[model samples]
Target: MSAREPSYFAKCACGKFCAELYGEPFLMGGANCYCNDCVAACYYCDDKARKEGKTNISMRCADYQGAGAAISCWLLDNLRITSGKDQLRGFKMSAKSPLCRTYTACCCTPMIYIGQKFAPRWRAFNLNCVTRASDGQPLKPTEMSNVMGDFALKEAWDQIPAGQPKYKMIPWGLFPKVLAVIFLPFLFPGSTVKVLEEDRAVPGMFIDAAMVTEVVSAETYVAAGVRVPKALLEDKKGK
Candidate 1:
């Protein structure tokens, strides 16, 4: 229901590791990443985990923020790891961005990509590690700044339900039209517009995958409220 409710649980591959949601989910939509370091890190991590016998690992979320506000919460300092600690590994990429560290501990599965930047209050957790009864369908990509690969965003748009409302208020289908009319000029050019897409390989990173469509420029299309087919988007070329 609401993001305030306890709706998600993170677990490792062995099902021994778990984390509870205590905050609203932040940045719960698609992102495009272009950073080379981000791409290298994700590839290395995923490859290493696969070799370690961890496959099909992912995070889970209770609700899609694209449909509502992100769940926000303070990290539970006393949370327990039920298993797979011996294989857990952590890496710190940038010192300026956030105190966040990516982890693959507990069965060599990519666990949480948490940070303290939104700290003293909110923390963003990777949705893939969360557990729930739902199929994790309409899977929303939260961040995309770290992706170095290509991706298809149109496919993701197709997954979102059409009848829903924007921000849980305005009618969903008409939301784009409203934005298009309101920001027509900015949608054209002579403006600093950046289009983003989600890199499935990296959690919480957005890369620039705005070239997947031809209907209109990414900026104009986004401003006009047209949903791009995720199938048209492609993740980075390799792994």
Candidate 2:
């Protein structure tokens, strides 16, 4: 990192997930997502692991980590995975949902939410998975959690920060896109479903974990990508 460029540390459970999120500190806005899409994304990795029957570590970092888990993040592209990039995987909550629910292939640690079609400027980091920086400070901590989605548990809504920004749903820009998807079929009967053009898998990607033989250590994990201080070790030291 350059003298002028500031950075913060974050990682997933069992040392399988970690990264130095680069950007202006606290420049990214924060929100608590109660959206089903966000919730589904949080569980996507776990669901995939079960379906694929791949060998993996215990479910430690786990799901979104219950209520009040607001994700504070920068743009999705800003996250530089320091290790276990192969473990990283993401899926759309729904075909029309904008957020690419991202997480690690090693375990179901809810990581970042990326945009596939829209809202490319923002990256939603799972606040639940963000660990402390080497300095023992939070990275892009949220001012408040934004409660979104048409349906959310009433108990979950009660956990919103007393003084932070809380939204009933997503930003105003999303309404039009959602409406179009909702009404497109009705407006034009027999219209085909819209799919992302870049959904095809690219070359050099391993289809299964058994295909990879390289040993991955959490310690080597940190230095593999962006540089982070020695003070912040993997969340689970020897797991």
Candidate 3:
């Protein structure tokens, strides 16, 4: 299942940066994560944009904050920075944190997140930044709850859809599911399946997360006007 053309197109708010995204969304495993990091990152991007006087870069920042989760598509092994890769910048929550969030330097549009969990193999694109589908229709792929219900802000937690399952952390079963998605093509090679090709992956950004100056932390989120969840605050205090 190789797509000669891009299935989705993602661009920064500034329109200076763009990427061609390929892969089936369902096969990629989309999810909504309610973890503190995910929530804080959204607030951080919004705050950064405001400070720089960059307008119209919202990309659902408030909506994600209000909904208490960040939805992402686990785009594994098929990404191409079509233009403005030089403007790509990223940051980590801390020196030790495995998560690295990349954004466009021009307008601070939060783009992709690659954590140690995904590592050299996968990248999760923020659903907000993915603005267009090749089909010219709205992009709506089914998603499952991924993690951290306890860290959602009170109001945000209340906004979760009824009957949607919430987890305090990533469920153990998630590992197997992820593994299956990654290896299925190799297990049964056929026209119906597609194995990820490193050669077609993102060529490389202007800078890796290591070079990004700012480090996000609890204090940083607070300074950015993000309301930390009471449960998260309590958990940190306990530690």
Better of 1 and 3 by lDDT: 3
Predicted candidate 2, C-alpha RMSD: 14.2
Model 3's lDDT to the true fold?
A: 0.59
Q: Report, for all candidates in order, the number of backbone clashes.
A: 56, 5, 0
Question: TM-score, each model?
Answer: 0.40, 0.53, 0.71
Task: Write model 1 residue lDDT over 1-239, tens digit each, in one string.
Answer: 75343445656556665555433343323222222222223344454566777663633121221111122222333232334433444454322233333545545554544433323222344445654325534334443221212321333233445652223232244446535633644566554222233222222222112211212222322432233323223221221
Off by over 4 Å in 3: 1-3, 26-29, 59-66, 144-146, 170-173, 180-211, 223-239
* Candidate 2 TM-score, true structure as reference: 0.53
Writing each residue's lDDT as its tens digit, candidate 2 over 4-102 gives 222665566566766667664233245666644444343444445567774333222223232333566554345555666555565543222333455
Predicted candidate 3 versus true structure: per-residue lDDT over 132-201, tens digit per residue: 4656554566656645666656666667768876667666666777677667656766622233353222
Question: In model 2, what is the error at residue 28, expressed in angstroms?
Answer: 5.3
